[model samples]
Target chain A: MATTALSSPAASGAAAAPEGAMVGGDRKWALRWAYFFLCLFAAFALMPPLYMLITGLKKSSEISAATNPWWVYHPTLGNFVELLTSRAFQIFFLNSSIVAVLVVAITMAISIPAAFALSRMKFWGSGILATGVFLTYLIPETLLFIPLFKMFATFRDWTGIELINRWYVLLLLYPTLTVPFATWIMIGYFASIPRELDEAALIDGASWTQTLTKIFVPVALPGIIAATIFAFTVAWAQFLYPLAFTTSEDQLVLSVGIATTLIRADVFNWGQIMAGALLGAAPPLIIYAFLMDYYIAGLTAGATKG
Target chain B: MANIAVRDRAAFATTSRPRGSAREFFRQKSTVAFFFTLPLILLIAILVIYPAFYSVYLAMLSKRMDRFVGWSNFTFLFTRETFWMVVKQSCIFAITAVIFKAIIGFIVAHLVHAIPNEGQRKWRGMLLVPWVIPPALSTLAWLWLFDPSYSAFNYVIVALGGDPIPWTGHALWARFSVILVNIWIGAPFFMIMYLAALKSVPAELYEVAAIDGATWLQKLWYITLPMMRNIIAITTLFSLIVTFANFDIVRILTAGGPIDQTHVFATWAFKLGIEGGDIPLGASISLFMVPILTVAAIFILRDINKRGERI
Candidate 1:
């Protein structure tokens, strides 16, 4: 029974014969069980975001009322409108956008050539350097934030330049988080490209830069997209770095801005807070929705393909 | 394809061999490679490597950082109850959350793998939503869900004729709540990774096991677990480090509150080092994470190297 079920050709477009019918029956049970658990897991996974949406659409009155907490009796756009129009929220959005965009650009600029060199060009200590890059990627930001904080403070003391409480410091700090992973992803993709492609370019009297720009970049476009998405998401989602580094309201990114600013002392504004949270989560969600295949490819490629 | 390229490269190298020029080309290529990697090396050196060593030095300083008090901070932390509690809590939080995340991820991956391929993409996409959202933002949603007055979960419990549990107001419950949220956020990552691993496992192995009169349990024990061992190890170690260092969930949810019962190394360090203005003490607390992280990193490096060899 197990053999027939496991070896069933019913999934491969074969018509179900008498024995194949039994196998299909078994497979059907398995599929049903799979769907049942998948639904359960999906609910657990999506509940918070769904709740954010539900609360984001509710009024403060509705939220405060002793009604069904799960459902919004009177959904309102007031929260969204208020958050979208608020000066503080808009500044937070703008700051987040600036940091994310600049970080992505810096990350790609640093990682692409590094990945190409590490993967394709054999050099002294290239192998150790690649491994060192991965190790650096593993170092969590939490471990470094304090020393970085002090370092920035000391820099201010020495050079009369303030690095802390500034939004732009993130552009310097975020690449530490992003470049190694992006370079690693690009290396995996580049290494898989047929060496013939680059060798042919080299033999055609193309400079190494010409070969990279013309041949490798075009071929590894998917990997580049994947790396870009990863860099963007990391930059956008980073919380600890911003929270530790930047303290002022105007300097705060969306994640830190929403968490710190939206909730005033001792008064929890669930409606507006949820609205802010939802908007804060929007860019990454939107990117994941459209480029989900590349997103997942990047994710799996990090562990499996590496 | 690789064979032909190698031969062609050999032919080209010999034909273009101007005895000393070959050495010069090698030198030129190395120079280009060095230039390509320069930015990365500088970034890591200034931001990552320098701070790492600085933290070590910072940890050895006095509270005011005016004096070098060697091992005094370490002794002080060892003497403190909160520091010990933080050590215990950090370990429990990381281990428990990683265990649950791994279990849930493995199970969900199997379920997703069992489904028809056509519908798999939609299910996989939906399931990964938790991981996609920024944790700081989603933890806010969780904070609302676990609200004392407007707790949706407690409301459900009351409707079912059970008592409304204080999700974060209590110490143990707050620990549970944080770990639950971490698992909820992290399990989808494990599921996605495991699902990819499952797809890569050849169908022939399962068929062969089935034909040998093996039960589904036997097949899973022999085939699936072994095939996924490297991924499982790497993912678990990676998750362990991340979870152990987790700040967003604990900080956003409880802020290591309920009298500091839920404090992990990161949040405790933050509370001590930044908020309290005791930078040296905080640096010392944060440095406690290095041993665990180093162990996990070494294990991951070994597993990745083993996988590289296998490939």
Candidate 2:
């Protein structure tokens, strides 16, 4: 849900334990029940993605109706290998990569300065504009895709240049998706910096641009990373936009492309679907695995602080 | 020397005129700020503002991207059985999913909050895996699990000496499956947010309640819920908007199928606008989503502005 973005990064310190705390009596029982529930939910949380890994490694012959779908016996990399080698799969991966990276870059470029202006440099209507930005972030592709589809159609009719069915056209649309949240996250981050930091620079004869580049950007590197991660994930995971905008085989991004290209005519290639899904999810998953704290921080930052 | 001093004072006033005068509309460094935000404002204008009004305009036109048909597309949709079905399905889908997500998130956050802080991070991280993964990719995995013939769930059911239910085969089951996936993907977020909120609920209150022999349910209802009321409202309202607009899980899982039983405004709009080639019809369907979202946004921004007051 787009409300997913409205959350500001929650502070890790919220869970800080009391010094020299002791557990006693019936509370131990409560702790045990807590762990029990925790394990239950963790299993529920983990099962599907874990199943994807198991299913991805299995061969088509092994994924039959009779076989145990839970266990991957005699696992093969055949699905992964086939998908990785396929040109269509590669194009999907490539388009997704291109779009995600470009979106992140553009998102950061626009968001950092904009966040600086909103958070650091006060201006007329900045308060209203900041709220407007957050409001824009809430506008999901569901509402936009129908209109976007028409807009693109109208565009082609007027300009004689096709906007749909092209990979690069996504570059134009993705900034809208990423920039708002990225700016929101950066605003939270920039606001956390003491006003003195910038004011001191101003007194030292530094310009606003110099203060931002020389100070805020470097100081808020973690926030930048957080925003970048969020943007990449959004761009990569987005399905409806690509589905509506790009229908052709070569032009499709991974999410829409996999759904359309692989899941054809009821002859479901379960192995390939799982494999492609895993492969497609790999970038964002890997990014989360490494920089999870930043990702979590960026998500909650808006809700908590913004 | 006195005249020169007065002249210097006057010169200083001139230098500070922008800040001192009533006419300093843009304020200090506003020029730099404007340049900084120009790209972002332009992007919102082009992609968001332009498209929004254009879609409304498009919805008025015929499918050929020509002619001013006024409210005919909306009228035409109102006449169709499928449109009403979609509206009903969307309401049921969003309301049910958000309610479940909130309740589940609260319970999980409480459980996570109960345990010692040492092990909480690991559990929180593990619990958040669903929220972290792409909804589209994860839905593929769900589809596999719901594969009627090859379902792992059916495998477990068979192993337990029971019949395998049609997971996505029947309309009822398909609706249930989509909502299940929606909850599975969304609830962890509620957990994370609620957990953060739970953390912010001062421990001293809980300790005092415990000293007074308060029951857990009493503490939750009287203390926890009240403390978390603002967050609960904002999060729920926000989630409602997102769930109403949800496309990936439904599209991936059911594609608004089984006789259009699961068609939310999103997938239904996509089907009509893009796939069905009735772009005007699709725009009309999707535009129906705006009023609810506008209401939600107003509530969120107002709440956030109030929070800004406290800061």
Candidate 3:
């Protein structure tokens, strides 16, 4: 995935040819057959998401006993309509949107500058700071949540400033996940910028601040978008932070919200669960669909740069 | 005129102090540089660096910090009944899944690369959809596919005149189920990486091999494998770190169920720390993950540094 960032430019060059390019002889026939099987498996691999869409469109009663489980008999928009209008689902979506947007903003704010400094400055501990930023990538969210949760609990007990079960709590916590990779990515982007431009800005009496803001930021726009999307996806789909810290219904993001709210102990709500699954998946899927090339470039840069 | 000349002389004296010393200071520009980087330094310190050290601190103390027991919790982990099983299961889950994903990904990537250019993009995009979908939602679809009574997998097996296997109930089967899901989620990464590596292999090498009368297998062994060595090594290491640390697939699929026979390190830690309230033990368990992941990180860093020299 990280290599996607590095290889996308090269990949686009290889992929930009016309469809009708020919392969010759019986070998071409075998090649076509091989493609046929691969595409078949690809379709089969794609069935689950398609099934979720099909199941989500079915009503609960029709889903349970429908003779053709693969096909929808009485397809209705009620499930989508209901979930859209439902207060609980709305809260889940709102929380997700807020968290994703805020995390992206915060990540870019911290990482872009940090990346620039690491790339350009001869400051003390620059190497250590750069290494520290990359090493944080290895720390899983699960490892941090327990200690963070305990720390937050202790703070609540002492100062009566409760950080748990609030959407804003993620504002502080998500950086642990987003900033490191985002910083690493921006370092790659900033390193690619010509040093002459910065030197020119300095000669013209621009402060380092003005140089970064006015010069590098505009040139690194694609990197920023890639980092933004990465942060957004992480925040939106994150399961552990929301599950461990924000357990309340209204506070939950889409990932934990659907898992906790839609299903019960004895009986799972297959229809509603699939419905929530599709809805939860849509934002990132839509984003990926549009910006996959840039997303890949961002990830590869972070990976290759690290 | 005398006052103005005196002022000009004072300004000239100030500017003449051999701009060398001050020029040298400003040349590297460490002070100005630090100003641009302060926010990042402060954020990582407060958020990442502090908490990382905090975990180690949490591990040294007993619950509630009432007692300080150095390495007692670490020893206690070995004494616990579920500890060894989790360590074993996590190793099996991560290693097996990574190997299969690498193989499958290589094959699919080679196949995708064989296609005409225009067909390749759409097919590659389709191949990558599994990775694009959120893991939680995709894993739910997997959960339903493994539902005991009415699984899509069981339906396919029965339709083929075979008995239904308990995909997530039995110990070995549950482990296999999780690994299978991991492969499904992870293989596309291998495909993408290998595809990139494949494209980087110059066409001239293959043409030369063909001119020398090399067979398909010879071309793969002699040209393709050697060309992709650096990327393959790095991608495998990357996948190993991610798969080893993976918490979601196991948690969502089994939650270490059917008598807790399926718990990996991350899930075991979660069960102990969050569910059972044993923060120290969980931290200790998580610490065990660091050594392997560190080695993986080093390889990745080496790979990245080598790449930096290239492009």
Most lDDT-accurate candidate: 1
- Please write out the lDDT profile of model 1 over residues B1-311, one tens digit for every residue: 88768877886786576756654564468778998999999999999999999999999999889999999999999999999999999999999999999999999999988887999999999999999999999999999999988899988999999999999999989999999999999999999999988988999999999889899999889999999999999999999999999999999999999999999999999998999999999999999999999999999999988999999
* TM-score, structure 3 vs. true: 0.90
**Which scores better on DockQ, 1 or 3?**
1
Report residue B176 deviation for candidate 3 (angstroms). 1.3
Ranking by lDDT: 1, 2, 3
- What is residue B311's positional error in candidate 1, in angstroms? 1.1
Better of 2 and 3 by TM-score: 2
lDDT of 2 by residue, A1-306 (tens): 555444422322243244312333356677888888888999999999889999888887887645877788888989998988999998899989989988888888899999999997778899889988999988987888777766777789999999888988889888888898889889988998998998878655566788999999999999999999899999999887787778789999999888889998587898889889888888887898889889888877767554
Evaluate every candidate with DockQ and list the scores. Answer: 0.61, 0.45, 0.38
lDDT score of residue B18 within candidate 3: 75
Q: What is the model-wide C-alpha lDDT for candidate 1?
A: 0.92
lDDT of each: 0.92, 0.86, 0.82
Candidate 3 deviant stretches above 4 angstroms: A1-23, B1-28
Give candidate 2 misplaced runs (Cα > 4 Å): A1-23, B1-28
Worst 10 residues of 1 chain B by lDDT: B19-28
- Between candidates 2 and 3, the one scoring higher on DockQ is 2
Tens digit per residue, CA lDDT, model 2, B164-238: 988888999999999999999999988888888888888899889989989889998889998888788778888
> Higher lDDT: candidate 1 or 3?
1
Candidate 3 lDDT over B1-311, as tens digits, reads: 78657766875565567756865445446766775677777876776667667888888889657788898888888898888888888899889999999999998988898888888888887788888777888888888878887677787788789999999988889999999989988998888888888988999999999889899999999999988888888889888988998888888999998788888888888888888888887888887887888889898878767876886
